[model samples]
Target chain A: MADSTKKKITVLMVGNPNVGKSALFNRMTGANAMVSNYPGTTVDFTSGTLIEGRQEYEIIDVPGTYSLEPRDAAEEVAVRMIRDHPDAVVMIVFDATKIDRGLYIALEVMEQGMLCIVAVNMMDTAHDKKISVDTADLQKVLGVPVVATTATSGEGIRELAEQIRKAQVADLDKIIKRLNGEIPDKKSVGGCGGCGGC
Target chain B: MQKKLLELEFGERGVVREIRTSVHDLNCMGIRVDRELKMVTKQPIKGPVVVLLGEMQIAIGLDLAAQIIVDVIGKDA
Candidate 1:
């Protein structure tokens, strides 16, 4: 009965492969880390806890995937996890160098109507490539919190935690209305139909 | 005659005729129908083949490569 009343917040960290998601997970969770297989799959995911003041958050490092379209077993697991956990906070760790490609997944995630945050990882490398992103402009565009981060060096992590604390459930109706006609039908976008062999 | 992209020899050039797999995936990588490409390299056994499309070098898996049919009109014509 006591456990039923306790509020346990869950946060999911998702991104493309090699986007520093595991590194960020380690930094955020420190020594309190545990690994468990995703429900009904062989793929295992890491989970840990982050405590701020009196509140505690459970953070899971979701398997890296290019899109939520379930192209493979890993991607299937990722898409299912996101779909099952509607109340979890979705944090997308994006490679700043390939923001355009990352946005593809971002659009899919936002359409799910979960509370979301964008962590633009690898900012240091983006700087090396002479690519600059205006975070304020990005925040205005996505209508959510956007934090620039370099997970390797622990930059912007504190700000990310603060934002996570403030994260709220996404306004699905408002977002869907604002992005009307933007989201493509699942069968048309990224579906295998070039030669009908799928 | 139409030949699979996997069958092209290194340094051989061909024009993409049809994609048997997901066209959206190819489009994401900047590949398109009628695009000219040159086989740059192919890994040992059944690995990905590297092709030069314009100024960009793309590596595609052998399974997907087989689905990309190209017509070899001539040698680097």
Candidate 2:
């Protein structure tokens, strides 16, 4: 068996475009930053070192894409980066106002069976629109910790970071099978109230 | 009459009548068929078109806008 203790922990930031992925990255990493192209790809990605408690995490800001499906060059880079680091903690930043679309991508990521956390960004806008989302309800549906946040104001970001540190791999085997059309069960499909997400 | 969203001039009003592609892409911006839209911005030559929908603003690529069919509302005709 390989030594798991030697493995380095990485936190990958991902979300749809304009969902404040970069803002969140800046908040988490502070100053020391490196903006570089992904190895052989022309697409650029930002990375920085973030220390949480006793552990140091290599946080990477991935390019935003609507879905894991590569519709363009930037999307290809994002998908490849996520696939390359299967062990990295995936932080999915989503817009609270556009939860349906965000949830669709969230399901796709979870289908890959990676450790994930759902950060419901733009909470301020959601509040202004009178749209209320219960993170606990979402957590129960996604089988992961869901944190509400307003990246611009830094609201709930501390709780998000703490949850990120405590993130774990979700049990998505059954859901993956269902999404892939290998099963016929629809009970869990509406658990999140038809928002296309939980 | 029905026309592509790309054809709608700035400040032009219309109702999104159809989306030729998957609704998933448009859903992110809260766009759906029958929603009232206003052309807020359209850059010269190949650029994204900004559309105002209620309180939300969505910037859509020209290529994608071509696939979105809208019925002219003629608010500022």
Candidate 3:
């Protein structure tokens, strides 16, 4: 009962250890990924199918890593997953309270020139801890569709899935320029607005 | 004083001083030199030891913990 005619878009979930990547993956794909509080819970990758906007996606939950440089077996697996699926759309997950640490690996993945989207997961915990991350600002900085999500309560899951099609390969130079305030705000300019024309 | 991370009792706080092995592995987990770490919990029978790194809690196995040396920084009351 599979649709052989339709091509599946591959999406790799990458992030630092224990940023709720597995939790977000479970919410998106309805697949039971081993979820736990501690880091290193997911030392391997799990695959699941997701259908959104009449398109099928094969989502792979990759092992968490702090950077692209392989430091351990789990990190090696994450590095290999990116190498194996060079064309896959990378879904980078970040703990809302620790976005800085997650950004390191996100930059590494973006440097590889893959289409990417960002999920600032654990919003509930961040809210409890009095931490707030501006997803819109992050989107502008990375030039990717960034969505704030709380995987535990199923908040913002639908919007994240819908934004997958809007994923884009970010330009490092552009991101640097935007961060330095060298580039004018795209929305104010009234061009494409970097919305992926959707 | 300097002691292996595994020797830090529960609720003990310390700053990482040296890592004898798997430097990259420990560093990736936020166990780099000069970073403050607090012992959160320890599993019995040599299981993973949980430590607080900044606002994050990381569970490191004993083998890796034994390789990390930390300078004692008092304990939480």
Candidate 4:
């Protein structure tokens, strides 16, 4: 079990584009400051901290990417960091309507031997689609905690944080098949929607 | 009262996290998006109000956007 207090753990916020990585960062870090950065402004990553219920943790919002391999300079940093191994990984935050595609990244992270907490984001849209995911089943298969959320409305941010605190490096081998023949290679995909579609 | 995607971020709104644009939309706007990002607008704004990829700004108006949402994101919605 990873101790939440002793080590300087960094929780990396990752997922496909537009699933609300930035929104989740704002919710977790309260980055209500720093708005516009000129017209052509682009930022690779941002760091924020969470001080909640007397517990503290560092959060880094990596640029969103589809895979974990370097296809471009910006995504290379994000993908490389995961391979380099930060502290913890949160995989979820993609098009809710595209669940199959979203799981692709989760499988990639699992391959890296990191204990993960799958965030099944965009429940509002899922509800609209009449899709009810068996979160327990997802947890059972993914071998980690799974929390559904509409990050913008902040439906499951707390659960996500709590789950992050509880994450353990589970057996990464169990998820090798679900990668859709792809790994956490962010370099293998398209450009970022950060300009801001994901 | 607005004509550009940059206009949406104005006033007291959430922090502008990202902006997504499409070359397809720009060709329609007849506006050259020299940089990697840009926005698109149409008259009467008869569509959904959306921020694509959060960048390639297209003010399709609410009615059109609602219809498009039902068509595009409805399957997932």
Candidate 5:
């Protein structure tokens, strides 16, 4: 249970189906979200509490969807969760092996102008497939905190939790500029990268 | 050799030809036309069928599978 005196931040975990969103949610919140390898395993949203570094988060495990366009009842629920929690920080989860597919929806969520962070889950499977995602590059391009994690093994989860405070509303134009090498990398001339952890 | 995805036997391979219904839903699930896929398993009693799309395995309901038309490529021995 979270202490009522502390301000609780709402974090919504969103991702593609079977991208380990539930596993990552269970890891962060210690909630028993049924984990499975198949898609549509979680059709409804589940909420739990997570206390990290004296800050409490009301984390909601949103049903996974490929896009905001609701084609099914489950997808409708996922879209509604984002609309209902307007001020919540969206934690977009992705399978490290299939970043492109997840990025499509991530961009859709970011386009709504919400504070967002990214967790690249399934690092172990990505490594096994010889696929490597540069989190630093992703962070620079999206202008959000991107953390690579293997939720099943509890790797990099702490950093993800700590970096939630650094979530940013991504600028679509700037993202394009950065991707095209039009803007200089911020890390080259920066103080703590404005991670709010200095 | 076009057939409904639901008709594909276990360990059969095919490329998606068309999705009759819920095109957006099936696309989101990575079942787009022209994407090669393999039938991994089909549960008895008209339960969900699992298919391998690239390195990912997706379990789709029988109704959904029945709507997906696939061009049979080969069968795994």
Candidate 6:
């Protein structure tokens, strides 16, 4: 069943809202992605093909999510993408200007047992705001590859592609256990946590 | 091609441009559009406002277009 010839890589882009995830998707796939202020515009998954190192890859852009737990239907899809597609490389796109919030999601993604790559998107904006993020420090903390990029202006897009070529397929059974067991019971999340009002 | 994209993204009639302020002061200020610049105002246009593409079907009239342009861009509209 394995072609064994052409290596098809699927890069899943996941992160918090307003980090220019769709913008980076457009730059990678050369597809003009639709952008908006409000979150959840990208509900379903989107895939595009890019030729890299004589191999074709199906780059995936999953919906924006905040945590490992399925906070809602969208997070369920995001977690499902990680569970169902273990072979895909997970690219955690975080806002350089606001790395604290995105970093939280990055930690949750790491818990999913995927070989993750952290890309700090919107460096230009961060720089303009006089905000600077130590990408090296982030990688150390996250235990993954960290890349700085200004996705809007096409900066650091090529490095992202080249890195995708070197992405490794993570094991699956291990991921499944985490999805089911690793998620903390909502009952312990305190009262009025939103979901089910329990 | 720019106009076509503007038409496609904004709508057939939705044409807006970014209007630069004259005083060049204040933390936030509203302005209008510059058809020549091919940009629009999105309110508090100060700071690093991300210029993004809006969905089609949301079309604005010429008067509103001039208002948006002049409101954010400048009186040149």
Fill in the DockQ of model 4.
0.04
B-chain TM-score, candidate 3: 0.95
TM-score ranking from best to worst? Answer: 3, 5, 1, 2, 6, 4
How do the residues A1-198 of candidate 3 rate in per-residue lDDT, one tens digit apiece? 335677889999999988999999999999999999888999989999999887899999999999889879999999999999998999999999887678878888999999999999999999999988888777877888998999999999999998998999989999999889998876535533364525
DockQ of each: 0.22, 0.26, 0.28, 0.04, 0.31, 0.02
Candidate 6 lDDT score at position A50: 76
Per-residue alpha-carbon lDDT of candidate 3 for residues B1-77, written as tens digits (9 for 90 to 100): 99999999999999999989977666655677898989999999979999998788888899988999999999997
Give the CAPRI rating of model 4: incorrect
Model 2 misplaced stretches (Cα beyond 4 Å): A1-6, A32-43, A128-131, A165-198, B1-18, B21-49, B53-55, B61-63, B70-77
Error of 3 at B19 (Å): 13
| lDDT (CA) per prediction | 0.75, 0.77, 0.89, 0.55, 0.89, 0.61
* Residue A154 C-alpha lDDT in model 6: 91
Q: Which stretches of candidate 5 lie over 4 Å from their true place?
A: A1-5, A187-198, B1-54, B57-77
Per-candidate total of colliding backbone pairs: 0, 0, 0, 38, 0, 15
Better of 1 and 3 by DockQ: 3
Model 1: CA > 4 A from native? A1-6, A31-43, A168-198, B1-20, B24-40, B44-46, B51-58, B66-77
Model 4 chain A: lowest-lDDT 10 consecutive positions: A188-197
**Model 6 Cα lDDT, one tens digit per residue, A1-198:** 324497787789999766788889989888766878677878888888777767677878888886666667887888899889877789989878657567667666666677777789989988987878877544433435677898879999887777664433333443354445653433423322111211
Q: Cα RMSD (Å) between model 2 and the true structure?
A: 7.0
- Candidates 5 and 6, the one with greater DockQ: 5
Interface RMSD of each: 4.0, 3.2, 2.1, 11.9, 1.7, 12.8
Model 4, chain B: what is the TM-score? 0.25
lDDT of 1 by residue, A23-140 (tens): 7788788843332322222244778888765568888888877777766787777887898888999998887876765676776688887888889988998898788977755664
DockQ of 6: 0.02
Residue-wise C-alpha lDDT for candidate 4, range A36-75, written one tens digit per residue = 3222111377888886555677777777665676456666
What is the fraction of true interface contacts found in candidate 4? 0.00
- Model 4 Cα lDDT, one tens digit per residue, B1-77: 21233343222122222224443333322222332222233344354444433223434554422222111111111
lDDT of 3 at A132: 82
